[model samples]
Target: PLQLSQHRVREKEAVKQSGVKTAKVKGVKNLEEIKKAIDEIGYPSILKTCSGGYDGKGQWKLLEEKDVKSINWNENVEYILEEMIRFDKEVSCLVVRGINRDIVSYPIGENSHKKGILNKTIVPARVSKDILEKVEKTSQEIRKRLD
Candidate 1:
């Protein structure tokens, strides 16, 4: 659980292996690797620390070739370059598992972010029933894989 929570690359790999769709991501260790990944993934992508970053603290958006030069790369810290995903709304579902292996999920919530910080969440997200079911199912799948 700790590993899955801390390592973004590992978590994404596990989710991908679990048959969940995710944005294209590449793990990079330095500027050179980041450049290579950018070439492969293309522009308008994001660079984020692999661990210990919260509330959008360790993130950089490379909107174009010139944007890459603006980041102060740290060779010592690992990073993940991800293709930027555009979406209309952001929703999240929380799943809890008990010691006896019983699992339950809360209703999906619509999330709003301000300057990359989570602002508020509205429970019972205003989404189609089909989308809600899919989100719950995806959350369950992730929980199973992480467990």
Candidate 2:
């Protein structure tokens, strides 16, 4: 659980194992690796610390070649270069598992972010029923995998 919560790369790997689609990602240990990952992932990508970052901190958006030069790269810290995906809306599902291993999922929620911070979340996200069901199933799958 700590591994999943603290490491973005590990978390994304878990998500992928659960059959959820995720942005293309590659882990890097230094600036040279980051440049190589950017070349592979292409422009409009995001660089994020592998661990210990919250809210909007420890992230940089490399929209173009010039944007890469603006980052204050730290060679010691591990990072992940992820393909930036543009989406219509952001939604989430909360799933909880009891001590006895019983699992339950709440209704899907629509999330709105402001300046990289979560501003609001509306319950019963304004999405189709099929999409909501899929999200819930995916959430449960992720929770199960975490166990």
Candidate 3:
């Protein structure tokens, strides 16, 4: 379950291995390093712990340089900075596979986030057929490779 356990790593590595373009990211060990990385990544970047974080528990949104100074750092933890993505919409694709390798995918679900926490999910997300297909295909590819 390495892929699933590494919540943040899977996102980056899946997009990379699948040849899908994703946000740029960097890992940092301290506040100073993060500030420097942000300068290169620009404002509106995301700062997240590399592991053991989920549901907005260990994430910070940096909309500006001043936001960096406000961070309360823990010397023992690692953090990652990611460029904020400007998306037309947010969606999640879920796939279920049995022990026999039979797989089924659910309709893409549109997602809403409030302060980086998933606020709502709507099935059969309102989108063009093409977008839905792309989402499912990508999800399936990831599942296959991980499996």
Candidate 4:
């Protein structure tokens, strides 16, 4: 199967594209670089690993400069800093494709997160028609690109 379905792949593709607005992100090697990244990405940014994470476990939120100073970077690991995005609601969609080129997408689901962990899912998110359409379209587009 195509690996483009992964978060890392999606992020790289987003960096090259123009439609969706993804968080501005950068990698750093040392504390000085981390400071520079904070200046560029701004406060309320997020620092996360590029792989092997789920349920929001491998990330840190920099709400202020103090949070940045509080961090103790592990030289053994790699990290990426991303500007935090402000959104009213979070929604997700699931897409499945078969070997015969058949694709199917489920209704968009509204996601409620607390402390970065998904707390609830409301099927067919209570969003406007336009937003729902956009979410579904995006899911389909991702499958197409990976296909």
TM-score winner among the candidates?
1
Please write out the lDDT profile of model 4 over residues 2-30, one tens digit for every residue: 44334553465553463554678887656
**Which is superior by lDDT, 1 or 4?**
1
User: Each candidate's lDDT (Cα)?
Assistant: 0.91, 0.86, 0.82, 0.76
Q: What ranges in model 1 sit over 4 Å off?
A: none
lDDT of 2 by residue, 24-90 (tens): 9999988788889988999899889999777767988889988888988888898999999999989
Tell me each candidate's RMSD, in Å, in order: 1.0, 1.4, 1.9, 2.4
Q: What is the C-alpha RMSD, rounded to one decimal, of candidate 2? A: 1.4
Candidate 2 regions off by >4 Å?
none
Residue 112, candidate 1: alpha-carbon lDDT: 92
The sequence of per-residue lDDT tens digits that candidate 3 reaches over residues 1-147 is 465447675567666676666788877889778978887898889899888888788988899878888889998987889999999889998788879978888889999888778999988898999999889888877777666
All candidates' TM-scores? 0.96, 0.92, 0.87, 0.84
| CA displacement after TM-score superposition, residue 110 of candidate 4 (Å) | 0.5
lDDT of 2 at 60: 86
Compute the lDDT of residue 137 as modeled in candidate 1.
89
Can you tell me which runs of candidate 3 are displaced by over 4 Å? 1-7
Instruction: Score candidate 2 by lDDT.
Output: 0.86
